[model samples]
Target: MGLVIPFDDKASDPGLEALVALVAADMNRVNQTILARTGSDVAMIPEVATHLISSGGKRLRPMLTLATAALCGYQGEGHVKLAAAVEFMHTATLLHDDVVDQSEMRRGKLAARLLWGNEASVLVGDFLLGQAFRMMVEVGSLACLDVLSVAATVIAEGEVMQLSAAKDTETTEDAYLAVIRGKTAELFAAAAEVGPIVANRPKAEVAACRAYGMNLGVAFQLIDDALDYGGQAAKLGKNVGDDFREGKITLPVVLSFRRGNETERAFWKRVLEKGDIAEGDLETALATMKKHRALEDTVERARHYGSMARDALELFPDSAPRRALLEAVDFCIGRAH
Candidate 1:
């Protein structure tokens, strides 16, 4: 067996806990596959990978793979390997993202790049990508490969778009959403869709899972952006003002900048566009966002997407997995509050 993350018995969300319990055995095998596949003879490869992998994360993406497969009545063992592949893909993205953002902390610890250097982090990320593909190939599902490979391409495109858009105050809300759809939602959609695809579910159900994951992923990223400014540091796993400091153009900043007065606009341009941030600028930015209800509005938009996610599952009959998936949308939105 692989390294198992101990589940907290005292889950506050009943639905989330139930979903975890429902897939407990499958997740165990998925964990084993993750640990097995991530190993490498290269000393630094496993070191950097383990540093990030062992760090605490909810492992929700892989869980989505497993849960969606079970939801479609899959009895095959292929889901275990596919679930691990999904996790590797997610972890690879995180490693690459930390490097791109020059982020210091990840999952409440020093980033892999910080400990292992950017060169090592990037190479290790490549290694993980290789492993993810290998696992996908081993599962031998053309549908799975198509979904995941396309997602890999979309995620790269999104990263490039985000790099180009960074510190560019003129980036529009629509453009921002586009970037996140590629960067975040594409993988989520692929993960869920692959589950049903491998399970041999109907085209309609597969499409529904894709829609659910796509909307849910958008909602998840929106909440993450909101939490960057409004959430507690302990709960958020990163500093509250990391986005502001990085000059990342997120939805809240777009709304605030578009609605602000001349002085406020100058403030945003100075800090975000020109990277001339002052000591108290984060406080000023927060105050401006609050005045414009930018954070609140962002969460409201997440709720809209969350609603879409919930509605996508209406095609599936009510079950523990269905209810849990519905509540998962609420869980995504609840992070900002």
Candidate 2:
């Protein structure tokens, strides 16, 4: 459903064309290398990996890594390895995510779990995780190893936390944000920071870039959650209400609970705690959100993070990549699907 972003009125928005163009260039090159690496494996292990990798995705993480490298004036071959490494980590999590969520769809296609069975997907996901570490080692940087390893640990920790909090009304914005950082933003931070790490760039520049990526990553996920219900089913590539169907509580739902009245909340409790929602339960939940304006408020929060992300990049000198990175901040919020 997410693939069909609203672009017909592109002219209504200013400054988006250039950023999308630059980001697309980086993604195209990354995609080629990714296809080759995932395809070159001589066995089914590589073949399944290739199938999943070749399945369409936005490739946002790798693009962020490579773009930050270019912005930092990195002129090394190591950036490709770094980009691929970021992708491997992302794909690994995705493979596991589908199994955990018991999801059957991703990127508008049957999920790996559906195609190959959960066991195969789990083992292959492990392969990708191992492959990611291997790629990190190939870069030959202990610091990169430290950064990615720490991010991986935090990601697992966050996933556990989210699992514990999945349908509980007790989950807070603080807990939600923590889970989000671990699940989504930490890698963004690492991806952008790895550029400076590989380039041997200044420490302060590296730190700032990391901050930019982290904030943007958080904002990106926050907006992604909002889009789950608000986005067109075609744009989302899944059922419009999958998150609620899975009993996954997102920021919007979290905030809606906070904002809801007793009667409204009982509806949530029925759907969430009791898991007895009727067919139109999602529409009811969405109405509550609209009534509370939770979606608008969430979008505002995402924009605030995007602003911070762009400001973090101010420490670096201007370049096309830098400009593109800055524009991505706006795209994260302005997009509709």
Candidate 3:
């Protein structure tokens, strides 16, 4: 029998409203910092950067930094700068990712690469990384700087790893996990860890925040992978079959390919490996995933990580921030429905 995770009808909002309310003031500062930093004498730099930055994204990673700092009772302005830095790092990655993937859409708008050529997109992404590091240096916390800098390196490595594994039907689950850890979870971990570090929290609390963010990031990516196959385009901010069309080897593809029969495996090899996708290939892929319960099991795996994220916060006391953090996990996992 397949694993079954309960879906809550009320999880529609993913508890983000509470988190937004909790971090409202600090987030405003972060936003201001972002807008100020994006400006440049080279007009194209701001033009390209603003196009994507202004696009509709939840700003969840930076929000994680702010929320974690609040949870740790931080009263300094360092968290605001760090939050803005985290957002810059994330935006840089998206700009680079769209160029690498040749993706046409991001956050429900034309990808920056599409609007401003790939060269401009890549250059602007570099500019953002430069700004992100500047903010980190200004904070003057070597420990926080180390965490975010290491995350930036790891995120780049993860992207390279994914590039190597792209469209390889034989890619293992371990390989995929390693990729996500570097590309996605590392930033989340760093974003969450820097908060407690700046707040001068206990070592255990710092470790707990790191663990929570890492697990939450993994869960968030897993749900995104699942959503690529089963979610709506409007809700996903991209075409429903974008991953399929791109020949990206996400978890659902890995699971379904492994569980498929000889004929089905050949079908995957043809579309994913050989890039011979034809009409109805996406439908067939989705059907194959459903037949093997690949999407459902992928979500079950996400629930496992979500549980770990919640448990990571057990060391913290009961508070609004803690509650909001816990609810954020539910929101990540519940987006599948």
Tens digits of per-residue lDDT for model 1, 1-337: 1111122223243336766777789898988887888788888988899888888788888888888998898989888888888889999999999999999999889899999899999999999999999989999999899999999999999999999999988889999999999999998898889889999999999999999999999999998888888777777777778999999999999999999999999999999999999888988998898899888788889889999999999999988888778777877776654
How far residue 230's Cα lies from its native spot in candidate 1, in Å, is 0.5
User: Which ten-residue region of model 3 has the weakest summed lDDT?
Assistant: 1-10
lDDT against the true structure, per candidate, is 0.87, 0.81, 0.92
Query: What tens digits encode model 3's per-residue C-alpha lDDT throughout 213-276?
Result: 9999999999999999888888888888899999999999999999999999999999989999
Task: In candidate 1, list every pair of residues with a backbone clash.
Answer: none
Q: Can you write out model 2's per-residue Cα lDDT over 61-115, one digit (the tens) per residue?
A: 8888888878777777777877888898899888888899998788777887888
Candidate 2 matches the true fold with a TM-score of: 0.92
Q: Per-candidate RMSD vs. true structure?
A: 5.4, 3.0, 2.9
TM-score list, all predictions = 0.95, 0.92, 0.97
Candidate 3: list runs displaced more than 4 Å: 1-13
lDDT, model 2, position 36 = 60
Better of 2 and 3 by TM-score: 3
Look at candidate 1 and tell me the lDDT of residue 136.
Answer: 93
State which candidate has the highest TM-score: 3
